[model samples]
Target: MNRIELATLIFDRLVSEKEKLKTEFQNSDSGIGYFFLDDLLPNDIALQIHDAFPKTEQMVLKKSLREDKYVAAQMNLYNPLLEEIIYAFQDKRIVEVIGEICNIENPIPDDNLYAGGISMMGKKQFLNPHLDNSHDKDRNLWRVLNLLYYVTPNWEETNGGNLELWPNGLKNKQITIHSKFNRLAVMETHNNALHSVSPVTYNGYRRCVSNYYFSKSPLNDSDRFHVTSFRGRPENKLSDLILQLDTFLRMTLRKIFKKGIKENPHVYKKEKP
Candidate 1:
């Protein structure tokens, strides 16, 4: 199916569950609101998305102390359906419905897909606990919501690669949200919204579709300009210290160069013919 048709299907599904989603988001713990829906699309369609993911070499491999995963923002380099599904979450109707559920006004989707797109992780790959970058590519707007759609089939929690929310910080146990097949997880992002993906133990890939919604105002009054901050798990003191320092240096540079020294290359530049 085409992008518009796919988007319409998703919009109708979300509309049917709007009230349930709103209640869940409002009552979530640790001051960070969120909601997840399983079987978001038909099983066949979701499986097709998983099957269409490109090989790891075709995507950007981000391997560091902070993360290990393959990401791709240049949609033209991969399957057209992948791009269609990614942007379907960005459809006006879908965005508007999400805004209403999260109780936000006038939320906007990032057309450039700054730091947003598709990602996949193989065995032993993980992302450390971290807060998302505060704003979009330009510093003008605050990133307020994160949308993650997991398409991998029959993914088991024991296989890891699940989403972990450290809402009360690393000291307390995290809330584990299984990255189940055909599930869509929407979470609020702010200064304190720290989250990460567990290491993948299974040999098979764990694939996901990602998007972020931005607003002119901050999600929380205390939210301030901060880079993507990382922290080691509670047991890893040494790594935590080093990551803290890493965040400081990046934050300092941003202070001096409001937009950073160079343009971040992780954006989709639509081809014009």
Candidate 2:
């Protein structure tokens, strides 16, 4: 099915849990305001999305101290199903409803898919605890929420690749959200939304469809423009220190260059035929 039909399904599922999700998010505001909904679409349809994922070789590999995963924002290079699902989350009706649920006003989806789109983590791949960049590609809008839809079938908690949220910072324990099949996790992104993905131990891929919602206002008054900052897991103190230094250098360059010495190549640039 196409984006419009798929968006209708997504909108219906979200509305079904509106009150429940709102309460879940509001109660978690003490830390990270977030909620996860399971079985977001019909079983068969979700499986179809799994089948449509591009091979890891076809996607861009982002490997460093910060993260190791395959990501694709150049949707035209992949299956049409991938593009449809990405834009389905951008559908105006769906966007408005999600904004309402998260208490955000005029939330906008990145059609350019800046640092947004699909990602997959294979064995040993992990995303270090980090805060996402505060704004959209142009530094114009504040990124307010992260929408992650996991499509890996029969993914288990023991298999790793789960999402971990550090509400109280690295000094404290994290809240792990299993990357279960057909689950959608929506979390507020701001100054303290530091999160990571557990390293995958299983010899399989944990695929996810991601999107971000942006707003004119920052989620918190204390929020400011910053690079996507990273930290090591609690056990790796040295790595944490190194990542801090990395963040410092990047932030310093941003101050001088404004948009960076070279434009970030992570954003999508639609090709005209």
Deviation in angstroms for 6 in model 2? 0.3
List runs of model 2 lying over 4 Å from the truth: none
Residue 143, candidate 1: Cα error in Å is: 0.2
161-211, model 2: which lDDT tens digit per residue?
999999999999999999999999999999999999999999999999999
Q: lDDT at 239 for candidate 2?
A: 96
Query: Which lDDT tens digits does candidate 1 get at residues 15-100?
Result: 99999999999998357899999889999999999998999999999999999999999998899999999999999999999999
Clashes of each: 0, 0
| Model 1 quality (TM-score) | 0.98
Clashes of 1: 0
- Regions of candidate 1 where Cα sits further than 4 Å from its true position: none
